[model samples]
Target: MMVMVLMIASYSVGSIKVEAAEELDLQAESAIIVDAKTGKVLYEKQSDLKLPPASMTKMMTEYLVLEAISEGKIDWDTTTQVGDYAYGISADPVFSGIGLIQDKDYTVRELYEGMAIISDNATTITLAELVAGSESEFVKMMNDKAEEMGLPEYKFVNSTGLSNEDLGENYPEGTEPNADNLLSARSAALLAYHLINDYPEVLDYSSTMMSELDDQPLQNLNWMLPWEDNNFVPFHFEGVDGLKTGWTQEAGYCFTGTAKQGDRRLITVVMKTDSKEERFNQTKKLMEYGFSQFETTELFEAGYQIQDESTLSVEKGKEEQVELETSEAMEAMVKTGEEDLYELTYEINENNLNENGALTAPVEAGQVVGEAVLQYKGDNDYGYIGGIGTEQRVDLVTTTGVEKSNWFMLTMGAIGNFFSNIFTTVSDAVKGLFS
Candidate 1:
């Protein structure tokens, strides 16, 4: 049968399709957990609701900075003098600043470390200005990058996650002065997915639990991470690392956290939680569920062929049929013991067939003749993030070449069929007359 299929080439065996675990009933207003490698959403609660991101918005700023460095637009040692706008914000003890001096040239590396490790408001502004010449222009870049990355719901008003009102007349131009940066949980998880996949070096900064800035100690806002001398004790999970945290009277407590445990990395977001401690506690619930319930399972090996539909009929070829197999192995992160819920279906390329539904002779080995789609027979099949890619389906290819039949053999077969038909017709006529 002819069929259409969706492909998620960047994901493993398409999206994880298995029975939904007991609902987490996450406490946050919006929350989502995604597989970092495949961009699959393991769990979501009101994930599409747009809400103020608070300092979590800095993750985009961090992404833009790393992109600039990789593109040769800036270097770690490249320095820019702090402007009065940034210097003014640094002097405020309430906004989480490391105290920058006016017009002091600071390296990109230093500013980046401050912004990432501590969610320093002034350092974020400085880095944005350095990369885009002004915070207003940088805001434009942030919005542009969000669209480029296929983030479905997002709005960037400033490089820092702080509301524009807090900027005190320094907010980016062309934006409402009272507006706050907003993003949906799904989009935040997607941004984190792209950030780590595109610039993994970011973890080097976000993973730091403590850093020193000009003899002043700056602690990461993400308390789930381990400290220099020991784990954070009560909150620290074994693989807890990167990401960013945010808070404001308007945004409450928000966190975009990522962790890796034995080759499997997960990214979680919790927004509008009641308290700082609650955010981490909610994150721990999501992380524990993912690690304990799901596992990377190989559904099919490379060269796997369908049981009854292993070959396609060939017309005028030495061999009557051509064997087919999958192009590659199929793997997925499915609930343990629920792997059998997946079923494979394939559709042959009708364009490659003749009126008689047989392939033309001279079929080349490894030629893709059709597609094999993997379907999930389970509930709560949250699809892959970004909803783009070709990994969801496998290409069905020929296993060996099929040569055309020689003219002599073709002629002989036709002659034999003609006589056999004539003999059978006469015998049937005589039998009918006798009866």
Candidate 2:
């Protein structure tokens, strides 16, 4: 019996060790795993570290261009003029050009395609100029947007990722190189998050592995694109889609990848990896780990019914009770082994409830009142993950006055009014005499 007890204790300790190792495997040195729905950082490592983001900066460029088109500042078919500044930048050996002609016109859609699909440096500059009047001004807008999004580390000196030469046209020459267009992996991931959520159509372009422009096949620069027998491609991972990839000798391999299974979408970022293949492999491993270790569980349907209370009291009102309901659905992300550990709890705002204890007018059937918090009773440190909402609506049968009314009470009220009017008359006469 003693030996058996010792064996059981040893097995329990070993199992715990294995579970701890699995949990640690979910993180990387410079990585983040975020929920596409709530923008929650489910897992992270040095996620806020400021680093060079290379071509991934183009995600912002692409996003702003899309916003311009959607807001009517530019149209898909509208032609934008390519100026000398765009042409000059394109001529640089390090920059990727779409062969934009000076003072020539290309449709807004073409410029977007060049920038997004090919990561064309010149086309991006032209689009920025058209949308914001100049790249310098556009960089200011980019930085402003980053600030608006609560990202303090990002700065933008140029729309394209090309190195800025200080030959200052705005100031005297010999000024320092503008360090404006710099971004950390976290900021890039935020941009990707916004793009995927706001204008998902951008993925329609980013996900395309190949597109033909000017009679040339513009293959996607992201090595994750499916191809045969390349060390960069992961044979096991499927359903992987394009996002953006970046590399400069200064900033090592960086990639932001998004993958989906059913309604669940995940965003992964890897930065400063040693080699091109390592970036892809690391991303693949992270994505695989996420998909395999977790599953999405819908805690509530969007319009599902919440609890109904038989009696809710109204203050200083004729009615006695009000009904309660939920305003919106609740959902949660749960770890694989701890699905049964979560429970929803709720509360009502007694002050806002109507005379009949129902929710007051301007209340929709599916409006939220109080919140339902998910509590984890499980032993694991993984914890709980969901919120429930308390909601209320008018009882339609009562609102329509379909219920029986007291005829005896109405008769008594009429009789009381006759005597009260006589008493009011006598009191007024006596007051007039005194005056």
Candidate 3:
């Protein structure tokens, strides 16, 4: 007789079943699925392997353009003049061009839409030039943003994914253009995650399966969109949205697909698949597995109580002890089906904490005073969570004529009392002798 054990995680919103011994069949050279909110890797297969990201590199380009618009350095409605450089870069056969006329003006918004929805190579280069003054400078900005996001595996050589040597027509002699862009599965997922969090408006274009620009119907390159006719890449999966797709003789096929199930959103990056259909199929399988197997659990609320233990001892104060607690509650999403529960350890800095340190002035309720580290010993490698420790200021006010007993006041009193007592004793002895 076979007995089946079912594990369920009950959350405030709903309950999710955590499947036991079930895993996703990720059929790609490299792949990763991450929680967009926490930057946690939910599932991974060769995630660190560096591979050509193909058109997914455009996500960063889109990010920089959107950032510039938000900064007021460029306006969506502002007209951008198409230059010889833009036209020259667009001529690459591998890239989708907007047929932008040289010296003709188009609003920054229109160019951005063309680059994002249509994946127009020319529009990307043109927008990069406008924002960074040149494609080279814009590439630098892309690399900078990647580093800022804590992604060290990414490198950008050009705004457009076209080969770097093809850029010589636009640049002068002795200038060698580098590879257009490169990223690992994890890094690409990070880029996509940043876009989703930073500029949700990007989905307005990425989610669009088809659009008409300049009398031409620009179809989305991402094949995850469900089509009425099942003839093309026939796999019906729900909740999938538009992202970028790429392929070359060297890069193979790559796709970054994002899907939403209720409030939970997952980003899946699959790199160097054998074919476009395989890439989408692999992504669909991974997404379905993620939704079916794991569920989110909110361990603690933002201001929930963390510790209610004995107060720490303080020196030279009216209050003998101070209450110790976290400004916020510790929360996490854990994989179900473990007999052994994970542990959250709180580490407070004894040095920064004053003797009998009651929260002092200028304290924010949720300010970090210490960190709560989480440790889990599951079949998967040990996992940890940090940054749950916090400090709040003590709202102590001095009463009239009553010396306020705080760290500052206590130190001053101790100094003054020692010197004043010594001087007074010396003067009294001298007065007695003179008398």
- Give TM per candidate: 0.84, 0.73, 0.77
The candidate maximizing lDDT is 1
Candidate 2 TM-score to native:
0.73
Cα lDDT computed for each candidate against the true fold: 0.85, 0.62, 0.66
Tens-digit per-residue lDDT, 206-273, candidate 1: 98878887788888888788755344556787798889999999999989999999989999999999
* Clash count per candidate: 5, 9, 8
**Relative to the unseen true structure, what is the C-alpha lDDT of residue 113 in candidate 1, on a scale of 0 to 100?**
91
Cα RMSD for predicted model 1: 5.8
Q: How accurate is candidate 1 locally (lDDT)?
A: 0.85
- Displacement of the residue 242 alpha carbon in candidate 3, Å: 3.6
TM-score of 3: 0.77
Candidate 3 segments whose C-alpha is farther than 4 A from its true place: 1-23, 91-94, 166-168, 171-180, 301-310, 338-340, 349-351, 355-368, 382-435
| Model 1 bad stretches (over 4 Å) | 1-20, 228-231, 312-320, 347-362, 369-371, 388-391, 403-435
RMSD for each of the candidates: 5.8, 10.9, 9.5
Candidate 3 residue lDDT tens string, 261-284: 777778888899998789889888
Candidate 3 yields a Cα-based lDDT of 0.66
